[model samples]
Target: MGASGPAVLIAGPTASGKTALAVGLAAALGGEVINADSMQVYRELSILTARPTAAEMGGVPHHLFGHVAAGELYTVARWLADAEAALADVRARGRRPILVGGTGLYFSALVRGFSTVPAVPDAVRARWRERGAEIGPAGLHAILAERDPAMAARLRPTDPQRLLRALEVLEATGRSLADWQQETTRPLLGAGAWSGIVLTPDRTALRARIARRFAAMAAAGGLEEAARLDALGLDPVLPSMRAIGVPEMIAAARGDRSADDAVAAAITATRQYAKRQETWFRNQFSDWFRVDPLAGEGAALATALGHFGAGAGGAAG
Candidate 1:
């Protein structure tokens, strides 16, 4: 944004040490850590989200971390708007802005821009979620299939989140989400504005990391955090509820599943989600350079920071 400043993005799968990499990079690059994580945005579930601790941040400024109440809904549009404001303010301060997280959708929204669809209300959402189960997601997929077969064709019947959202846009606004997306398309950061590094550890390593991290997290307050949020009883359809281990953990903590079963389910879910992220990155974030931390974590950080430095003087792409 200025003649000189850094706006860097560090992205990767869970347990890839993205938070440490981000903080270290931000500290080294004279940057503030701006959260790009979807779950970390919620105030009530820090441990479960693996949000950077205050001590971990090491006196560096962090923005949009635990700023929103969990009960409140968040959307890509709102996050984009918030990110826009944060970037402006960070640029004004003449400090680098380091964006980091594992939320692929958040990263995609930042790099490719997002549609500004209006808030889909709770009553409407409740009805849809209820209907989604009763009619089955396949039934909803059939409905979406009639409206926009192209989008529906790609979605699996079991992706209730996608199905519900597609239907919500159609029923609530009488316009398909795809149509709204087309009209609201905006370039992310104009053109060639920033640089990014995606931490791409080996597949086996990444899976082990996800599993081990979840296990450590479960020991280190993730279950408590999830239970606390679960007790709040917010809309079950909310995005946070579907966070990789939240549901399974919640059920496990409540004795619905054995601890072993819960762990396996969570790990399986996370790995599956990571696959989705990988596919998304391949398809959408084809421009980013990949960094394999397995080689050397420090080297990966250096490469990421170097990209930021290179792109700081250029306009956003």
Candidate 2:
């Protein structure tokens, strides 16, 4: 990434104002923001993903936000590739790069290196897809349990995609997915090249914020956005289709659920997702700087700047 200063990483649970903090940091440091969130990658899911609006971006350059189509498949490998290019470009332009998101895996891959799992052949993948469709996710997971018990035990029975992937990898290479994950390469963001922080708000306050923010999203044409995405007839297996609010909104749009009920379900789902994210950050990023949002953004900004050192306030691009 050239001879640039250390990059900044801002991670937190959903609805914890990660984007706002990212923008503020970028403004303070003359940095460009790069998205590390999975949901924010899809172009059709701005409202549901809570992606930053232009006004909220506040003139700082933002990359890898809403760049992928809903129907496209976006894997972590692809994200790493895109992120590496973005980081290099930002550094080459003499601007600090600030990566922000709730996706723990993205940060993990960036800082701790990504596993080089071999690609399953298309024929094998298609065969598994057919078998999964015929037997259902539970049945496929049962088969996975028989073939690769260690991998199967790690996956939920209801998660057909992972179950199928594990099954295909086992059949194709005779090795479990877990086995492949152990052999990882060098991290993209080497030591001394980056700084990271996790924002943790009070659980009660964060829950309240999640509920309120989701309600605001619904009121701000989130349902319409969901409906438009649904109309595209994308496969349910696509990562974009699995966005938190999309399924509930789709049910409401199809008359299978009331709009109010759908909104409630979506909010509950978001809260649950946020809780999982919080736990992940607690366990996985315990070493990074942790800020309590209850302490206010001023305090959080101070901590981030302190961690980033003298280059925290660089010239704007």
Q: Tell me, by lDDT, which candidate is best.
A: 2
Model 2 lDDT tens row, 1-317: 54456788889999998887888889887789999999999999999899999999999999999999999878889999999999988998989899999999999999889988788898998898788879988999889888888999999998886787789888888898999889887999887778878899999999899899989998999888988998999877677887888899888887899989999999999999999899999999887777775566487777666656644322110
Model 2, TM vs. native: 0.93
Predicted candidate 1 versus true structure: per-residue lDDT over 1-317, tens digit per residue: 78435467777776777777878877787788888888889888787777888898888899999998888878877888899999988888888888888777787777666777777887898888889868877899898899878779778887788888988877788887877777655655755566677778889988888888788888898777878888998876677887778998889878888877887888899889888777776676676777777666587777666665564434332
How many steric overlaps are in each model, in order? 8, 0
**Highest TM-score model number:** 2
Candidate 1 similarity to native, TM-score: 0.90
Q: Candidate 2: where is the Cα deviation over 4 Å?
A: 1-4, 309-317
Candidate 2 overall Cα lDDT vs. reference?
0.86
